[model samples]
Target: MSFYLDHAATTPLRPSVVDLLTQSLLTQGNASSVHSFGQKARQVVEQAREDIAAAVHADRNEVIFTSGGTESDNLAIQGLFSSRNPIGGVARPIIVSAATEHHAVLEPIEWLAAKKNAQVHWLKTGSDGRINLEELEELLSSKAEEVALISLMWVNNETGVVQDIPAVAELASRFNVPVHSDAVAALGHIKVDFATSGLAAMSITGHKLGGPVGQGALLVSRKTKLDPIFHGGGHERGMRPGTLDPAGSSALALAVKSAVAELDQSIQLWTDLNLRLVQGVITAVPEVKVVAVDLELGTARVPNIVNFIFPGCAGDSLLFLLDAKGVAVSNGSACTAGVTSASHVLLAMGYSQHDSSACVRISLGHTSTQQDIDAFLAHLPEAHERAKSAGFTV
Candidate 1:
């Protein structure tokens, strides 16, 4: 049997959500139109927004729907950057984030720095993938005026390492600097509270939580200022402009609600499976090095993911070998960035280039089962051994 463990990329959709999506697709109306049909469609979209907002403990007005996580990240980063005021006649263009963030957050910040004249303050992470909270404190204390916004991920997508987002938000707030978190990996894995998080914006996507692709929302605080990235009909309170999608909205809401409702059971199941997988791998391959294995509970890495390194193996080779054995995994954030190079996250955490290149990520989700994990471990030993024999590729 084929074992699929790449849930971080996207998850299997729920049949109920699929049904709602199909029903919404059959409904005839443009959400922006003023006609009766349009009004009906608008109701569906509004209901969805309300449901999703309730799921995340945010006000419905703060939810700005976008195409997906990447778009949400783009809108948050570029929008906030363009809207920041000048400090001493120079634009507040410094964007701060950790190198362990996913490409969705990293690329946009890098783009702003490379082409938009924004300066990026890269926060260094420890070997366990934990960011230096004191460094963030110092940065905000000294450079508050020059900093535009601080973007960070709620969870490291590859390693499942959870960041101290609340701490980050609190520090940035003290400096009057806005904070944006890409909570794509944290929504169902952890209970996310946007209203209480003190964030300027929080990005979330549908596909990550069993909703369809091309559906996401950016939770923008009412007090935050951001320019529109997509200009047109002035949708989403002038934050994101486009024709609102009732089907996607409704489907996303259902998926999120379902995931949230089942969170307790899901977490228990994932934790067991992850511990089994991690312990089994360690026992089977004594050389395996687990990332963030000591992350404390209640505020540590999510259990759905396990990142590890096979000292002398190429991550890509092991990935392909596992695929050949009908078990699938990723090197790290495969969909967001090319896996040809060593992981920037590992490098940022001070892992050697060789170990970084040999790292792989296995992520689980709602549909994962013990049998699927058994299938994974069945091939992991041989894959690791063969990959190590093949040696590293640059």
Candidate 2:
């Protein structure tokens, strides 16, 4: 059997979610139409909106469906920045984001800085992957009004590091700057309540939580102001305009609700699986080091991820070797997997190029089992040996 250990990339759609999608696809009419069929489709979409909102503890009107996380991130960042007041008749919007954010967040902020003359302040993180809150405070104090928005991921996709969102939100609130968090990784793995998070907006994707791909939503607070990124038929309150996919929305809501309901048990199972994986790796390969193992559990991490720095082996080589042995995993983000470049996230965490290139990430999900972990551990040492023989250095 193939061992799939790359939950961070994308999770398998739940069987229940697939059933919901299949049934919803048979329903007739566009959500935008005013006819009876259209009204039925519209009801499905609105019910889904309400379900998702309830799952995240937000109002139904606050959920604006989008294509996926990337679109949501762009809409949140660019929309907020464009809506900001121009400084001295020029748009001098500032964006403060962590150095460890996914490319979806980083690339957009970079575009704002390079093309829109926006100032970008990148918050540094320690080797443990925790953002420096003091640095954030300093930046906010110096440039509060000028700062348009702050984007940070609630969990690091590479290392499963959880950011301090409440603290970040409180800081942004003091300065009246809107905060946007990419909660894609944190959605099913953690309990995320928008009512308590104090964030202006958050991006969540469906595929990350056992739903279909190409569907996501931005949780926009009713009080927060944002301009439309796309202009068309005034769908999603005119913030994101297009024909809504009722099937995708229904699947997303059902998946999210199921995940939320099982979150506590899922967290516990993942924690157990991660502990087993870490311990098994340590016992099977004495030379390999588990990165950031000393950090307190659940304090800095999500329970499902275990990232390791394998000495004397290149990450890609080890990954391929494992693939040859019927196990599949990733060395870095799925979005950037084909590039073969060193991980920027590991580099920002103060790892050397060698260590960064030698890193591998194994993320688990609802379907992970102890037997799967054992199977992976069974193949790991041989994979490491072959990777070393192939002349790929640590």
Candidate 3:
């Protein structure tokens, strides 16, 4: 059997979610229609909203459906930045985010800076893949009034490093700056409650949590002010204006609800698998270095992700060899997989370009099993040997 280790990139839809999607596809009703069919469709959409909200501990009205994570991030960042009415006439609004954020967050911030004259403050993270809270406080304390929003990811996509949401929220609260976390990697693997996080908004995608692709939600607090990116029929409380996909929403909600129900068991399974993988790899390849290995267990990360670097070995060559052995892993984020450039996240963590390019990421999920972990371990040595023979020595 093929071993799929790249769960961070995406996950296969759960069987129940697939069934729900298939069934909902047969229903005929536009969510905005005034007839009985429309009402039924609206009910399904509302029920999905409620399910998603409950899974994330958010109010049903706070969840706005979107195409996926990228769109959600864009809407959250741009919507907030654009809606900022200058308090006391500030020239340019400042946006703060960590240097290790995903491209979905970084690219939008860059655009806002270059085009909209929004100032960008990139927070420096430590070697363990966490933002320096003291530095963040210093920055936030300096000109909090000029800031529009602070966007950070709940978990690092490549390294599985978890951030202290409460700490960041508290910091933002001190200055009354809104915080938006991209929780795509944290949703199913950890307990994420919007009510307690004190974040103004968050981004979550369905495919990352065993739901269907092409669906996601932005959880916006009722008090958070945002300008709608699209203006039309006023769907989603005039925040996002496209015809709602009830089928996709229903599948997403079902998957999220089910995943949340099994969160504890799933986390334990990931912990077991992570330990097995880490121990086995270290034994097989003694020179390999596991990033963030010294971090306290269950404190700095989700149990599903482990990243490592093999000195001098080309990550792409190792990835191909592993693929030939029916083991699917990744050199970096799937979004930037084919690109030959080094990882920006690792660079932000102070790794040299050579080390960053030599790194690989393995992420697990609910479907992972011990057998799959064993299969990966069995294939890794040969893959490393082949890569070494190909002049990619560590």
Give the winner by lDDT: 1
lDDT of 2 at 368: 84
TM-score: model 2 vs. ground truth: 0.97
**Model 2, 238-258: lDDT tens per residue?**
799998889999999998999
Q: With candidate 1 superimposed using the best TM-score fit, by how many Å does residue 276's alpha carbon deviate from the native?
A: 0.5
lDDT of 1 by residue, 83-175 (tens): 894335437878999889888888888888888888999988999898899999888888899999999999888889999898889888899
For every candidate in turn, the CA RMSD to the true structure comes to 1.7, 1.6, 1.8
Clashes of each: 0, 0, 0
> Residue-wise lDDT of candidate 3 within 82-134, one digit each (tens)?
77854554353899998899999999999988888888899888899898889
TM-score of each: 0.97, 0.97, 0.97
Off by over 4 Å in 3: 86-92, 333-337, 391-394
Question: Which regions of candidate 2 deviate over 4 angstroms?
Answer: 86-88, 333-337
Q: Which sections of candidate 1 miss by over 4 Å?
A: 86-89, 333-339
Error of 1 at 377 (Å): 1.0
